[model samples]
Target: MNLENLRREYLKGGLHRDQLADDPIVQFERWMTQIIATNIPDPNAMTVATVDADGQPSQRIVLLKGLDQRGFVFYTNLRSRKAQDLKHNPRISLHFPWHCLERQVKVCGIAEPLSAAESLKYFVSRPRESQLAAWASQQSRPISSRSMLLQQFEAMKNKFGKGEIPLPDFWGGYRVKPQRIEFWQGGVHRLHDRFQYTRQADDSWSIERLEP
Candidate 1:
């Protein structure tokens, strides 16, 4: 296969500075609402990037479970690799690949653990199976076989036995308080339109157009 031949012009639309919101959180909400209305698969999905103590970087896709002025929120095992990385270096980045709409969003921020009450609120709202899975699997850890994992899952099911599955001690969520946000729109001839919003010390945002 000739990879170089795979090319297509982006003609979806253009993003302009005048069209952007002064607050990036508002801008992100606007885009998210539009995408949600379009019924795209996993519209809440985002790629989270983190770095470990030694400066090794890693990335993973996580669903955006919550979003507001406080920033983006997602859950995971506290012992997971991404969580470990975040514990070492609170700096994190998020990417929303809305390629189906020829758009994307990038976020740079600090990752902080959510309050226990907040995590429990979302945790109990999850389906029973998901709640059990949280207790069954040791995320980012190697397992000898699929069967062994399934066995643990089954064990969790029996242990719960129709009772409410309490949130695991090692499971919770984090909020990414964004310092910078960028919105990108696909333009014809690869001349994409990009706008960046940076947070100021006064808790306000400054917007600027960036070259694509």
Candidate 2:
């Protein structure tokens, strides 16, 4: 496949200062609404990047389960590899690449575990099979075979026995309260539009343009 031959103009849109919301959160919500309106597949998907204890970097795509004015929230097993990385270094980054729309948003922040009650609420809303799988999966741990996972799932099923499946102590949600949020819009000849909102000491935001 010749990658260079596949270039198509990124004429989907443009962003201007006059059109941007003064508040970054509101600006983000507007873009989110546009994504939703365009009916892009899995618009909530984001790449979560973390650094391990040894300063090694890793990243993977995760669904954006929840968000609010405070921060962006995602859930996973606290014992997973990414969770271990967060345990060592709470500073994290998230990227949303809406390629079809030629747009992206990057965020960096400190990650902190959400309240236990919040975790339980989301856990209870999940399907029964997912709940059992949550209990069965020893995330980031070595396992011998697929049969072993099935066995564990069956065991967990029996243990719960049509009862409430308690949220595992090792599983929960984390929110990344953004200190910096950058919005990127692909433009002609790679002259992209980049605007970043940096949090200030007084809980205000300072917006700036970045060289692209």
Candidate 3:
């Protein structure tokens, strides 16, 4: 594989300043809607980054479950490695790269766990098998073998047996109330368009153009 040939030129999509939104959240919604309209696969997938106590960062892709003006929300086992990192350091960053659209959005904020009622509501809406699997898998834990997981899954199925599975105390959602948002659009010769919206002391947002 030739590393140099791996590059491909980006055609000017003509996405300019006039296309931007004054409110970042509204802009986000508009772009997200456009993504959906484009029929891209897994548009909700995003890379979530969290820092450990040592200030080292870790990142993984997670499905976006909810979003609003307040924050972006995602669900996972509360005791997973990511969740543990959040416990030690609430600050997190999320990135959504829609390569097909030649656009990306980066968000940074603090995370907070959702309420028990919210977790339970979402939990019950999941498929029975998924609910059982959630109960069986100790997320991020090292398992001896795949067979052990199958056995545990079967055991959980039997225990829950067509009954309402309770949302594990170790599983729930977190909302990242963004302090900063950056929108990037591809341009000619890497002179990309970058705009950032930062939250001010008075809770209003201030927008500025950034050098790519």
**lDDT (Cα atoms) of all candidates against the true structure:** 0.94, 0.92, 0.89
RMSD of 1: 0.8
Q: Can you write out model 1's per-residue Cα lDDT over 119-200, one digit (the tens) per residue?
A: 9999999989999999999999999999999999999999989888998999999999999999999999989999999899
When sorted by lDDT, best at the front, the candidate numbers are: 1, 2, 3
Best by TM-score: 1
Of models 1 and 2, which has the larger TM-score? 1
* Model 1: lDDT to the true structure: 0.94
Query: Could you say which candidate leads in lDDT?
Result: 1
- The digit string of per-residue lDDT tens for model 2 on 10-121 reads 7766777777787888998888888988897899999999999888999999999887889999999999999999998999999999887899999999999999999999
The residue pairs found clashing in candidate 2 are none
Cα RMSD of all models vs. native, in order, equals 0.8, 1.4, 1.3
Residue 28, candidate 3: Cα error in Å is 0.7
Clashes of 3: 0
